[model samples]
Every structure is written in C-alpha cells, then in structure tokens.
Target chain A: MTTIQLPPLPRVAPALTCDPAAISACGADLLAASAQVDDLGTFVAGRARVDDWTGEAATAYHQAIAPTGRRADAMSLALRGVAHRVEEHSAEMQRLLDRRTALEDRQQHLAQQVAHLRAEVATTTEEGAAELQADCDRVAGQVQAYETDLDTWVSDLATEESEMSQAFTRVLGADDVDRIYGGVADPADGPLRDKPGAGASPAEVHAWWAALTAAQRRAVIAAAPGAIGNLDGIPASARHAANTVALGRDLADYAHTEDAGVLTDDERTCYDNALAADEARREIEGRHDPVTGEPIVAQIYIYDPAAFDGDGAVAISAGDLDTADNVAVVVPGFGTDGESAPYQADRAATLYESTRVLDPSATNASLFWIGYDAPDNAPWDEGYDGAGVVTESMAAAGGERLADTIDGLRASREDDPAHLTAIGHSYGSTTTGHGAHDHGLGVDDVVFVGSPGVGGDTDHASDTGVDPDHVWAGSNSRDPIADLGNHGWVHGETVFGAGLGDDPAEDDFGAHRFQAESTTRGGAYSFGDHSKYFDHDTESLANISHIVNGDYDAVQEAEHLHDPFLGPVEDPEYDREPTSPTTSSLTP
Target chain B: MEVVPVSVGEASRAWDEQHLDLDAAATQIADADTSGFTTHVRGAATRFLAQWQRHAEGLGTVSEQRADGLRTTIADYVTSDEATRGDLVALLTYTQEVR
Candidate 1:
C-alpha cells in the first residue's frame, strides 16, 4: 500500500515578463515562434526519414522520368512533377543545417566569454595581494625610521634638560629671583607655583626645584620616581618624584664640563686638588711586619697634594655644592699594587679630585686608596697572590700591617681622629673588614665598591664583625664582576650585606645597596671596566669621594637602587646580631 | 671562663727578672753564640718595652672594665715583641753558621 510520489522541480527565477497582461501576450508570441521552429524541425526530420525508407520509389521515379510521347507527354509531366518534389526536399535540408549551425555558434560564444571573465578575476586578485605586501613593507620602514628619530630626540633632550636644570639652579640662588622672573626674560616667567623660590635664601641651594610646565614636570617624574613631592599645583607624589629628578638632573648638569654653570677657576682648583689627592699616585711598600714578622704592606699615598703643598686653599661650601663633613676610606681591589700602571695612581687621585670638584670645600673630608697587596692577574693567584693564599695566611699578615698603618696615621693626625672614612674595592674591601674585625679600627664610614666579600653586613650589626654605624656599598649593574665569582659561598653570615639605604647601582642589587649618583653608572672613563674603581672619570671615583666625605644624602639621591634576588635568607643566624659586640673583638 | 689574670706589676716583674737571663739564652739560640746580635736586639727591645710600659702606667685603675683596653695594648706590645723576636730568630738562624 505504499504510494509513489514524484519529486518536485526546482523553482525557476520569476518569468522575465511576469505581469499578467504582458505574460499572456508574450505567451502567444512565444508559442507561435516555438511552433514554427518545431514544425520546421519535424518536417526536415520526417523528410530525411522517408527518403531513407523508400529507396525503391526514388529509383522508380527516376525511370519513369525518361518514358513516352503521348506517354512522352505524360512522362514529361511526370518527370517535371518528380523534379519539383526533389527540389522542395533539398531546400528543406538546407534550412535545417542553417539552424543547427546557429545554435552551436551561440554555445561556443558563451563559453569563450566565461573563460575571459575568469582570467580577469585572477588578475585582479593577484594585484590586490601585491598591493597589500607593498603596504606592509612601507609601514615597517616608517616604524624603523620613527624609532631612530626617537632615540636621537631623547639624546638631545637629555642634554637640553641638563642645561636647563643648571640654569634654574643658578636662578634659585639669586637675591632678587622673584623680581628677575616676574616680568623679565622669556615668557616662561610668572608667579611661582605655590610660592616656590620666593623665600629662598642665598646661603646654599635648599632643594629648590625650579618652575616647570606640567609636561616638563611629568618628564622629570618619569625619570626619577618619588623625587619631588607634590607642589601646590601638582599632585604630591608626582611633584615629589619630579623634584628628585630635577635635583639629579640639576647636579648632573652642574657638574658637566660643557655646561655654562660649571665651577669657577678658584673653585675648579679646589676640586682638582681633592680629586688628585683622592686618586693620588704613589708606591705602596710591602715589608716584614714588626709585629707579625710576616710580610706586610701599607699604602703610602697622600690623599691631598695640599698635604704636600702649603699654599693650597681650602673652602667649605663652594657655590651650590657642599663639602662632606665626614671622611671615608676606599681600599683598592685585586690587581692593585705598586706595579699597577700609572693610570691606577691617576684613578686614585681623581677620586679625591672629583669629590673636591663637586664640593670644592674642606669640612674634614679625605679618601684613601689602599694598595696593600701586589697586583696579580687573578684574584686566585696561587703563591701569595690569590684569594686562597690571602685567606689562609696573608689576611692575618695584611691585618697586622693594616693595624700598624692605622696607628701611624693616627699618630700623624691625632688632631683629627674623629672623622675618618675608609673605602674598599674588591679584595681591598676584604682587607678593610679584616682591619675592622681584628683591630677594632675606628672610622666614621666604611664603604665597599665592587666587593666580592667583606665578611660583614650593615643591617645585622651583630653579624657585621665591624662596628662602623655606616657601611655603604656601590655595585652598578654595569659592573659584570658584581654578579660573577663564587655566589654560593656563604658570604660570612648574610648572603649579602645591607646596603647604605641608597641606590647607586641600577640593578635590583643596587636597591639593597648604595651608589654614587653625581657620576653616571657607566661613565665614559677609560677605566670603567672590572676592578677599575680608581679609573679616572668613572663614577666609582665620585662614589669613593662621597663615601669618605660622608655624603649620605648624595649617595641616597642617586636613584640607582634595585633588588634582583628575593629568596629568604637560608641561614638567618649568620646574619643575626651577636649577643655581645665585644665578644667577637679581636683585640685582647 | 675562670682564666687566671696577670697583674701589670706581676707581668713587669717577671719580664725584668727574666730579661738578662733571656738575653743570655738569646745568645745561645739555635745551637749558636749570637752574642753580638743579642746586644742590639736587647737594646731595641729595651727602648720599645720602656715606651710600652710607660704607656701602660698611664692606664690607671686596672679592672675588667678598664683592663680590656690596657690588656689589648699590652697584648699588642707582646705580639709585637714576639713578632720581632721571630724575625730576629729567622735571620739569626740563617746567619749563625756563617758567623
């Protein structure tokens, strides 16, 4: 009982002329045309079929055509009639051939048009892809050009900013600063924001960051965070950061050589001498210790040529710069010995010189480069030169020699015993720590730069083994050696000591350490490489000067702090303060 | 913790009594007669010890509180003496057979 159903035909597009009246009219015409074409086709086909079917009749008609006279007359008529029928059939076959040819031509023409259209579409698609590729390349070129331009612009802006900072700092010192800026110079002048620079005194610069536009202030804040507190007009945090940036920018600019506001002649002389003394070049003599009977060496360089020159003048506060009130000692690292190059001596001398140059005054400040051991190529030289030899035996010997050296200096300058600073770089720092540990040496500050180990910490006073309340460190990210060497060795108790609460080093390690800001992290000095603390023009020199002079604020302001290692200390006891300070005392 | 302490007077007396005899022994050190060496050494030691003793005298009221500083100075002098003696011994030993 299953019913069969026919599939419906696919719907066709609405008839081209679908209006009822037009459709009816066109239908009659279409039917008539179709009928005519069909009738012509049928007639041609039927004639061809009949001709093929009746070959005998065709022969008979051909025969009769030639037959009789009265029969000839009749034959003539019959022949004529037969000829006419043959002519009619021939004409119909011609018509059918013509129609078939037209239909074939139309189909060929349509296929050709379709092929041409496809070729055009392919060409257009290829062109579009090529255009897109060209656009991408152009964009990349523009990006690279922009990057280069930005770099150049930033470099130029840095230079300009430094100059502006110096100029503004000078303006801050003027007696009638308000009057000068009230309506004078350029259009940048106006009422001070929140009465800034209005009550400024002429004695010394009091952190008076000059008036800056909002954008300029934002740039400063971006450079050094938390520098300037918010002024009346600006947010407190943003302003504070900007001010800090301005201070660095200003001081850094003020110290620049090409800048307009650099130190004057007399001022330059003071700074030069101090820098020279700080980097004083001299021969360090190692001899048998009178006490330990061991070979001991003492650094015999003068911190100041003034100590040698009687006519030298000393000032306390030159211009906006202030001399350090305290003193510091900087011990040179490994490879520092009498045989070290003359540049070594220059580097040591330059440290004192740069500090004096920055401060240009004498407020009980001095620095020393302790070249206690002969220079060796490696920190691990086997026979009396390496760390192993030093730790096992030379340390005690150096300690004795150091004690004697300290005693000699004390005797020579008994008048000023209170303000002394000691700085140590690399292995020299270890030597300084030994001196402090074994002799109970008295110093205002002990600073270590590029130190491998000093066996002490500033934060854990008990574990420090040295008693100096202020211990500073300067390890710049630029110094590769700071991260090199045996990191796993328990550096005494603390993995690393507490920094002087300032950032001079740019790495995270710098945050936990102290740094010298006035000088750039990696200055263009020739001696900016490993163990080049005494190198001339390097920030290490400035750092040494600051430490010995007890410029705590300056060191803190450098903004070079960071902390790379954050894991909790493994052995806290090593960093814990000792129960009694005197217990670990090496004296009696 | 209960280590016996040496008084400055006692230490000084012990050094004084043994001073001459020690000088004799210094001459006979390392199986050699260093008589000439002993005289110079004794002279230097005398001057150094005398200065040290003078300094020690200035440190008054010896007790645990004050003794540490004085003791450190004394120990330092003793260490110095020992070191100097060690140096002299090494040099003297080298020169003994030649003499």
Candidate 2:
C-alpha cells in the first residue's frame, strides 16, 4: 500500500513591496502632464490659423507650425495611454495586496495550530497520543493547502507585474504612437471612420464606444471633440472633456477672428453661447461637495453653441452621473436658453445638496437639462410675440428629444441603473408630459412643478407612461401658471377646459400633490411664486428632494384642487415650516 | 519678381511676435516634469521629452531666423524707397529748371 505525501508548509506568505499610493500618484502626474501637452497642442493649432497673416511667409509659418501641433497631439495621446495603464495596474496591485494580507493572517493562524497540536501529542498517553497525532496530521494537511494557495498567489503577482510591464512597453513604443495618433490628423479619416450613424440607439453607440482602444478614444477626442461632445451614449467624463476642449478651441478661434474684425453675426452668437456655457461650468465647479469639501464635479452633458438657431442648447450636471445612486433631471420652461442655463444649474446644485443633506450616505446627481428649445420669450413680457406662444407642436418636438436623452441615460447605466426622476417646471411640464405620453419616458418617477399643463392629450397621470401612484406635482396656491388647465375654476365653475391638459395638481388627475408655497412672500395671487418653487427653505424643494431620494413616506402630501360646487373646497397648503432647520434662505 | 501686397512693418512685427511665442513654447516644453513614473515608464517618458524638446528648439530657431530675415528685408525696402523718392524729386527739379 502506498501513502500520499503532503508538501511541507510555507513558513510565511510572500510580501508585497509595491506602494499603491506611489503608483496612483505617478498615474496622476502622468495625467496632469498629458493635459498640459494637450493644451499646448490646442494653442499651436489656434496660432496656425492666422488668416490675417498672408503671402509666402504666412504659408511658410503655417507649414512649420502644423506638424508641431500634430506631434503635440500624438505625444499627449501616448502619455494618456501610459497613465491609464498605470492607474489600472495600481488598482490591481492594491487588490492583490489586500488578498495577500488576508492570506498571511490565515497562514499565521494555521502555523500556531500546528504547534499546539504537536505539543498535545508529546504530552498525551497511548490512546490520547493517537488522537493528538490525528489532529497534528489534520493541521499538517491544512498547512499544505495554505502552501499551495501561497504558491498560486505568488505566481499571480509575478504574472501581473509581467503583464503590466508588457503593456507599458507597447504604450511607449514610438511606432505604436504614430500608428494610433499620427494618421488621424483629421478624425474623419482615422478613429471616427466607423462612427455609428445618427439614427443608432444609445445602446449601439455605447457598444461602439466600448469596443475602441484607449489610443483610439484619445485620437477621437483630439481630432473631433465637437462631433462627440454632445453624443448621448458617451460617458459623462468623456463628454465633459470633449466639451471643455471644444469650448476652449472655439473661444480662441473666435477671439482671434473678432480681433481681426472679421467675425460674422452668426459667429458672435455662437461665441456668446460658448461663453455662457463656460460661465455655467465655472459656477458649478466652484461649489463644494457637501460631504467631502472637495469641489463638486460638473459635466457639460449637452453643448451645442450653434443649435436652435443660436438660442443654443446646454445641459449641466452637478455631480457624477455615471456612479450616482439617484439622478434627478430638472427641465426648465419658457424664457430659458444658454444665457440663463447658469441660473438653472444653480437650482440643480441646490437640489443635489438637499438630497445629500437628507441622506448623507446616498450618492445623488442632479442635472439642469435645457436640451430642448423652450419658447425664447416669456408670455408675460411686454409686447409678447406669437413666436413664444404656447403651442402643442413645439412641445411634441421637444418631447421627442427629451425621451431620447432619458433613454440614453438608462442605456448608459444598464449594469447599475440609478433611480431616475424627471421634474418639469412650467411649460417644460408640457414637454415632459408629451415625452411620457408619446415616447414613453422610462423613469422611476415624474414630477410637474408649477405646471401650465401636462400635455394637450394627457388627462390623467396614468397616460404619462408612469404608474399613477408614482406621479407627483407641486403647485403653489399663489402660482398663476399652475392654474392654466382644467383645474382652474371661476365662481365654482370650470373656466379653463384642458387647454394644455388636465392640471397635474387636480384631484381628478390622480397624482400626489405636495405642499408648495412661498415661505418668504405671502399673498393669495403672487405671480412671483410661480418661479419660487425651487427656492431653498421651502416645502416644495424639500418634498422634491424626498422623492428624488426615494424616501416616498417622508414626502408631505397636500390637498389637490377640487371644485367647490361638489363639496367643501380644499385650499392649497401655505406658510408651512421648512423641512430642515439648516436650510439656507436663498432664492432659486 | 511678383508684387507682394505686404504691410512690411506689420509683417515684420508679426514674425517677431511669433518668434517670441515659439521660444516661450519651447521653454515650457523643456520645463515639463517627467519624473514620478515607474522605472520603465520613466525611461520612456524621458526619451520622449528629450526628443520633443529638440523639435521645439528646432522650431524656435527657424522662427528666429525668419524674424531676422524679415527685419533685414524691411530695412532694405525702406532704404530703397527713400533712394527712389530722392531721385524722383531731383529729376522733377531738373525738369522745372529746364522749363
């Protein structure tokens, strides 16, 4: 009979000598350097477009500078590739080190057990000795198992190091740089050759993006930032980078042309739009994170300075959309455009803070999505033109774009979906209503605040493609715009008959109406209350934050508008105490 | 020779300004920090930085040369214009005397 032999136990687990912090720091340094190089490249490209300088000397200057700009771009790409690999390597090393520490602790415990078992065997008598010996053998087998695990762990560490080295070698190769970024002077000729068609769904765009290499992504961003900056399926970080680059380039080019006195009226409008976008981004970036005191992240998710006939389109998010646990998109109504987006971003930031204050552990993101062309003028303005007239056609068109954006958000986060809420204010509520009723805006909840209407065809919450129970509305009693639907009554008789649609705050509309009243201003018919729903220290903002955090029970319910002829009429709640004591007395 | 519709002073100033910009750019590139990378990555980055610095210096040198050439050309054009004006004035005076 043959006995199976067990290998001797390892005395100790292998040590991990690499410092993950140092590795991570190095990665960060590489990224910083890469950004600097990219800036230099942009500067060179702008300088090369010296249209005012003419003749043979000008041609020679352009020819000399163009190649240098291209080289800068290639160098930037190479550094970024290396930085990405280094960061990934650092993360993997950290994970491996953690595993190694746990393994070492286990081995130490087993080694102590072996010593105890051997001591017991030495001190026991004949029968006890046999039992002790068996215990020793069992411990020995465990040690052998531990040895095998350590061996595998050590091998894995070596393999990881080898793979990292190989990756660095490939990223740093001169030929590799040329092959990736050299040929793509114009993005259309290189990385963007296989770009998905405009009609492609967000999922298809996401798939196409995921298939590209790091080098390819860098090339695309360097070559054609404007093309992909507003593309729906791209990640928020990438979009932010691309948009920032595009904005910088445009500002430089336009400023140069303006200096030369050759800027067209259209170019001036676009330049103003770009400036507004930059201002919004700067304002959001200046805000601090509620929990960490770090600067809050702001992403320019939509930036088309020339869209909507120079009224332009822009959307800014106040947090990291990709990783947030809850995301709230606040859509604005009439009189909002690129110029007013900075103010809208402030509301988004306020909502983000309110959500964080309510649930400190939950990660939240909020966006001021002015992605659609709202009526450019307020209806109440003097000599109001019919161009800003409330019409169903504009709402219908806006709804299509809104639906596409929401769908894109869902598709981009399929692996880990956030609890998304869409809040529409004033005429924007009509757009959101049509988006839900016509295109099925798939969201966890839909909110209409101070709404003029929901939709021309939507009569009930159920028709908005969301569960009737999940539909919510906030209409201050003093808000005049909130009464522009079937809910408005005159002398106990319905005066406004579903012109835009049934008011979302109407009892028959089947939506939960939340208390929304002006806290600072008191009056029965203050038109100013129409725009105060998002003000801090107000019930409206608090209740909206609760819904966004998915704390449905915490939402304070208000009586919906009902006819006085039927029974005792219910007046809207007013002058309620603010939900949080730490609320700031800031206007929206 | 082709007649160039060039503003000589403006063109010369522009070349001089470009030369300054190219020199500043080259200096910035040279001053970029390439340390803190992993051993192999550091080596690669050092090599790339060196190569780029050389290229930038080359561009800066060329820009300086262009500026110098433009300055000399501008001086020559000014001198030749003055000489031609003096000769024209002298011939006009001679014709008036003959009349």
Which candidate achieves the best DockQ against the true structure? 2
Deviation from native of the Cα of residue A422 in model 1, angstroms: 0.6
In model 2, the clashing pairs are none
Query: Tens-digit lDDT track for model 1 on A1-588?
Result: 222221122121111111222222222221222122122222222321222212443344224222210121221122122222222323433333344344345434444544444444345555355554454344445444444544544454344334423322332221323333332222111222323453232111112333456544433333222222222223323432333323222222223322324345643544454443222222111222222333222222222212112212111111111123544445555554422323344443344445544454443333343324423445544333644322413333454445544443343334435356666666665566566666655565666666545533222322334443475566544454443322332233332332112111323222224432223334322235455555444455555555556565655323333333664222211222221111111233
- Show where candidate 2 strays beyond 4 Å: A1-191, A378-386, A488-499, A564-570, A574-588, B1-99
TM-score of chain A of 1: 0.35
Which stretches in model 1 have alpha-carbon errors above 4 Å? A1-328, A363-371, A379-384, A387-393, A456-469, A484-512, A516-528, A532-539, A557-588, B1-99
lDDT of 1 at A422: 63
Looking at candidate 2, what is the lDDT of residue B63? 47
TM-scores for chain B, in order?
Answer: 0.24, 0.68
Candidate maximizing TM-score: 2
Model 2, C-alpha of B44: deviation from truth (Å): 16
Worst 10 residues of 1 chain A by lDDT: A313-322
